[model samples]
Target: MKNLPLSINTLSKIIGKNCIYVDKTKMAYQLICQPGAFFLSRPRRFGKSLFIDTLKEIFEGNQELFKGLYIHDKWDWSQKFPVIKIDFSDGTLKNSERLDKRIYEILYDNADNLQIKLNLNRDIPGTFGELIRLSDKKYGNKTVVLVDEYDKPILDNIENSKVAAEMREGLKNLYSVLKGQDAHLQFVFMTGVTKFSKVSLFSGVNQLTDITLNTQYSTICGYTHGDMERQFSEHLDNVQWEKLKYWYNGYKWLGNTNVYNPYDILLFIHNRMLYRNYWFETGNPTFLVKLFQKNRYFLPSLENLVVTEEIIDSFDIEKINPLTLLFQSGYLTVEKTFTRRQRLMFQLKIPNFEVKIALHDHFINAYTDLVNEKIGLQDNLYDCLEQGDVRGMVQVIKRLFASIPWRNFTNNDLADYEGYYASVLYAFFSSLDAEIIPEDITNHGQADMTVKLANHVYVMEIKVVDNANIDDINGDDVNVIQHNNSALKQIQAKGYAEKYRGIKGITVHEVGLVFSTTLKNLLNQ
Candidate 1:
């Protein structure tokens, strides 16, 4: 087997060191051949830095590195331009003063590389402007500017509004210099995870073309299906291809083809093809969890959330939508898009198994008081489902509800609705990485949830009883036992389990759960 370029980000190093590389030079050449500046927004660990380094090598006229690449003959080797690269992903930038110092240091390093001296008594914008003009003058060619993680400074302080705003202004001041130095610039590319408005970040640079959702370049930063088959065929042996696609593929922009997560693929291959949450485990979603809790977002709705193009693209510090943040941050992707009366609409969902399982794990932690016990609960739940123990599953669920503090139910409005219980149950099953379908549809009606195991199918119906609406049976109120029985009867009456009857070698199990507003524990099972 060939060596994988797992940690390599520099184009020259990958090419010179004989590492495996997916050919993206043709797309890179096409991007540079176009006119005007460009901006691409993709999630982190999506090969943006490697692409930036490839552009750097191309503009610096490193023709030897392109020997076996598509851009070898297409690009002109004699016409080399001076390159100015800036990477904001390096160290922490907590305040405005640190941001200014970092920009000046980068500019000074570029000037030194081109054998030019810059005046030390200027602000960041002034120093940057001088560096661009001087580099162009010395190299006798228009300079190419490439910036990586341009939004990191602001994103680092996103939780703090005042600090984030200050960082945004500092970056805006530095970027505003690009407009005046356009005369000496040949090409410019800026990449980041989030897309702040042009008026906020790129203030006066009005000519920037955002190709974030442009169909033509949608596969610019990821591996397509053809890429995996052709470039990575050597590692396909003994690997479950369908499961690989299900876990890592399905990330789409506007193109017909879906893209796979490069980081996950590399780690999967390196670890002897053992499937795991490689990329999702690398970062914590604390901010996202806080946002969801603060906004009281319905977690189940994330599977098929609808929004307009304007809503997804309109991200600012003053008004941040959790859905938009989730979409831009790669937790959710566009499952479908359509035009409704001249307005573009999208249906977004969790991208793949890796995201679906990991995100819900965090959601379970944030929603319930079982912070340290969630993993054990998830394991027990998975074991019970695998063993076809309906009674054990019911007991586990009862324990889950009993663990919730009393204040959680009374203080939050979400607890008043039946959907809240269903959502929590969905999160529990989903965290185990089970094949779950919420609101599973059948010819007769919709089931609350369905869990599919290897040899069994679990069809569940949940009912929430109001304290005031208890029925009187034989002069006594109908207890939780009757309500639970009613739920199971309704499932059978609607033929919810009949839909799976045709499948061979699978046993179908029916479960009915009822919760009373007055009683937090499981009233019926």
Candidate 2:
């Protein structure tokens, strides 16, 4: 089997070294054939940088590299254009001054590579504009500008609003120069993980087309199912194909073909077809986790987040929605999209098992008191469920709640309602990577949570009673054991497990949990 292109982001290197290359040249060709600036937004590690590099090589008239690709015979490689590529993934830009310094260094490097000299005293925007004109003049052809990770400067400081705004303005000024240099540009392409509003990034560049959700380029950056099977056919032995798809595939922008995370697949094949959370493990989403904690985002609601096109496209530093951030950052993907009354609407979901597990694991660690021992506890919980040890499972959950620091409850509004505990249960069960559902709908009503094991289905309903609420009940009737029994009775009375009544070999486990605000423990199980 050929070697996987693990962490390789250069198109020329991949093609020249005979690495596994999914032919996205058709899409690349289509993109450049049109005469306009373009922007594509995809998650990190989704081949955006490689795609940009491919465009650079193509426009630089490296026809030898295109020997067997789709665009080899189709592209007009006779005339090469001057390419000015800038990548923002190199350094940290904490403030506006740093952003300016980085941009100046990049512009200097580009000029140096192209053998052009520029005025040293000018600012970044001026230097950038001069570089474009000089490159165009030197080569006697229009320039092709490629900006990779275009939003990195602002994104780097997103957690700090004051600095992030400064970076945004600095980038905005630099990008605004592109509008004026349109006459000297043949084509311009900018790729990033998030889509900041054009007003902030592109400002006067109204001609720039955003193809982030355009169905035509949906498969541009990631590998489709066909691409995977065909490109990596030699590595298929000893690999679970269906499980591979379940773990890494299902990222969709539009159309029928779901794109797999390229980083996951590359690492999977490189590691001898092992399945793991390769993509999510590479970067820590501490900022996103902090956002979730601050917003008190209901963790379970991420499965079916409904939003409109405007919401997805309306991502700015000032108005960051957790759902939008998740979707654009590749943690979540569009599960379904449709037009409702002529307005486009979408339902977003975690893309696949890799994301589902990794995200919830991080969420559980951040939202709950479980820290270093979460993995061990999760493993024990999994074993309990597999062995049908309901009491063991209850003990695990009780221990989890016991670990929560009292201060967390005081600060979080989630402790005020039953759904808060339900959300915790959902995150915990989901971290196990089982076929679990939150707020599972049944014939009578919605169960708090449901877990479908190989031969068993666990239906759970959780109820939380604050100390103040317990005071309303009679002194003799308001015991924790009574509330627990009431919970079990409600589950049976409402026929929560009736949906699986006639299932052939599957046993249904109906679970009832009641927590007391005063006791801070599981009142009943």
Candidate 3:
């Protein structure tokens, strides 16, 4: 087997080094056939930069690189376009001024590479347009522009809205030049982790077609199962194929195929097939988790989310939808698409086991004060549930709820709402990679949550009561509460566990939890 190429994204470098190349030139040829501005959105490290580099090589007429590739005999080798490549994948742009400086540097580098002298005195926008025109004029060919991580400047400051908006406008100025330079451009392709609304960032370049959801080029970036079986079979001989797929392969784009994240695949093999959260560890989703916590997002809803196209399409700096951010950032993926009332809707879900575990683990950090101690508690909780020790599970969970710092509840309305507790439970269970259904629908009613483990299924109902209303009952027997229309009584009365009772080899367990706002912990379990 050839070298994995690891983090090497340069097309020429990979080919020259005899590394494992997935051969995306066919898609590149197809994309280049259409001469127009285009945009693609994909999660970071999903081979977007490599795809951009592939396009760059193809347009630069590097015919030798295509010797064994699909586009070798298909393209005109003599005609090479002046390639102007812009990459924002490196470093952070704190404000508009820093962004402009980076743009100037990029333009200078491109001009120097093409051996064209740039007029330093021109404004940033003028300088950009001049670079395009001069490149076209000097090379006797229209420029083919390719941009990678076009939104990184903005995304780098997403936690700070003001700086992010400033970065947006700054990029808008640079990208705006693309529209006027359209006459001198042969092809344009820009890729990023997130897609900003046209009105917000691409108003001037409105003609750019967004192929983010286009099925034809859905496999343009990322590795498919076929790519693995054909290219990396040697490296994966000892690995369990199904286990590997379960951990890393489920990302979809409403296309015929689902692809695995290349980074995960490379590292999984590099690390001796140890199934760790390699790709996820590279990113910090603290902001995303904070957003979820602030919004009190129901954790289990992510398992089976249904949203309209507009919801997942694009977001502006003025309004960032957590769901869109999640989907665009690789935390969530499209499971399927269906039409609802003449509008397209998508069913989104956590892509695979790695994400389901890592994402919810992050959520747990944001929801509770367990911090680094969560692993032990999680193990204890899992053990209890695995052994069907309902009482032990409740005690572990009570410890979990009790671990939350007082400040999380002080002068806050979190304890008054049952969602806080449910969200916590959902995160804990999901972090274990258990199948969890929030608001589980049954014939009688919707259970607060349903947790499905190896052979045990837990049907849970949660009730929140202000401590002031039950002051006298604080130290009373929890069983007494169970007898008086308690959460468990509600489950028993409504028959929430009936749906899972008859499943072969599955034992259904009903559990009820009562939380006290004043006590800031479970009063009964």
Candidate 4:
């Protein structure tokens, strides 16, 4: 078998080095055939850069690289366009001043590469337009502009909204030239991780078609199941195909086929087909975790969350939707799409098992102070539930909550709410891969959580109480004990376990966890 192209994104290098290059030229040809200005948004490391490089080679008339590829025989070899490429993937541009400087440098370098001289005194936007016009005039062909990581500057400072907005406006000043210089451009394709609203980023550019959700281009960036079987067949011999798919596959973009992340596939093969969170480790989602905590987001709602098209289509800096950020970041993907009330709706969920584990692990780490002890605790929780030891599970959970650093509860009102406690439980259970339903709905009411194992089902409810009076002589009159017991009572009263109890070979366990803010741990029985 040919060598795996581990992290080798350049199309020519993959072809020259005889690395395994999945043939994406067919889709590339389709994209370039009638391109005015196209935009594609995919998660980071999902092969957008490599796809951009492929388009660059195709437009530059690198026919030898395409000798056996799909576009070799069909594409016109004689017609070569002067390709002006702009890539923002190198490093972070933290502010608009630096962003403008980078744009100027890129334009000058492109001009130098194309052997065209540009007036250095003009502003970045003017220089960019001049470079396009001059490249076309010099080469006697309209320029093909391929912008990779087009929104990196903005995304780099997304946490700092002020700087991010400045970067956005600076990018807007540069990109707005595209529409005015439309006559000089043959094709313009820009790829980025997230799509800002057209008015926010694209400015006057209205013709730029967003092919992100277009079904035709859905498989353009990722590896389909057929791709893995056909291209990496030799590398995948004797591998557990089902487990591999469970860990790394299931990224969908409203297409019929769900594709595997290319990064995961490459690393999986290189590591001798071991299953791991290869893609998730490349970038940290600390911001997302903190955002989750800040918003007090419902963790269980991620399982079957339904969103409208408008919510996920464009991101606004002023109001960052946690769900939109999660969806766009590849932590979640479209499980299915359907029409509701004449409006298109999408149901999103965790893409695969790898994400399901790694994401929650990160959350658990951020939620508590037990850094090195996280795995041990998770394993303990898993063993307790696997053996139907409710007491053992309760003890393990108490340890989980008790381990949280006091600093986490100091500055925020997180300690006073049920969501904070329930969210922590949700993360711990979710990390263990127990079949979890948060806010589990039943005929009677919604339980805080429902966990399904092989033969045991855990129906749980959580309550947070200020039980400081439990130590007083007349604490019983304050009803602290009654309040603490009501958590379990609610589960039993609502018949939350009724549906699972009748199932054959299923043992339903009702668990009530009452937490005391003063104790910062489970309430005393």
Go through the candidates in order and give each one's C-alpha lDDT: 0.84, 0.83, 0.89, 0.87
Candidate 4 positional error at 158, Å: 1.9
Better of 2 and 4 by TM-score: 4
- The candidate, 1 or 2, that scores higher on TM-score is 2
Which candidate number has the best TM-score? Answer: 3
Once fitted onto the true fold, the runs of candidate 1 whose alpha carbons sit more than 4 angstroms away are: 383-390, 405-414, 417-419, 434-480, 483-512, 517-519
Show the colliding residue pairs in model 4.
none
lDDT of 2 by residue, 192-305 (tens): 999888776677677889998898888988998898778888877667778989999999997677998888888887787777889999877888988987777777777557
Clashing pairs in 3: none
Candidate 3 residue-wise lDDT at 148: 94
lDDT comparison, 2 vs 4, better candidate:
4
TM-score of every candidate: 0.89, 0.92, 0.97, 0.96
Candidate number achieving the greatest lDDT relative to the actual structure: 3
Q: What is the lDDT of residue 314 in candidate 2?
A: 47
Candidate 4 worst ten-residue window by lDDT: 469-478
Order of models, best TM-score first: 3, 4, 2, 1
lDDT ranking from best to worst?
3, 4, 1, 2
Over 1-525, each residue of candidate 1 has an lDDT whose tens digit, in order, gives 566898889987787778888888998898888546899999889999999999999989999998889999999889889999999989889999999889888888888888889999988888999999998898898989999999999989989989999999998998888899999999999999998876677777777888888898889988998888888889877667889999899999987889998999899888988888998897668888889878767666775588998767748887788888888889988888998898899988888999998889888877786788888888888899899998799889988887877877666665556777877788888777677777779999988888886688999888777673334212233354445466787898999999888788888998877776766555666
RMSD of each: 3.6, 3.0, 1.5, 2.6
Instruction: Write candidate 4's Cα lDDT for 418-457 as tens digits.
Output: 8777777888888988898888889999998899876899
Tens digit of per-residue lDDT, candidate 3, span 25-74: 88788888868889999998999989988888888888888888899999
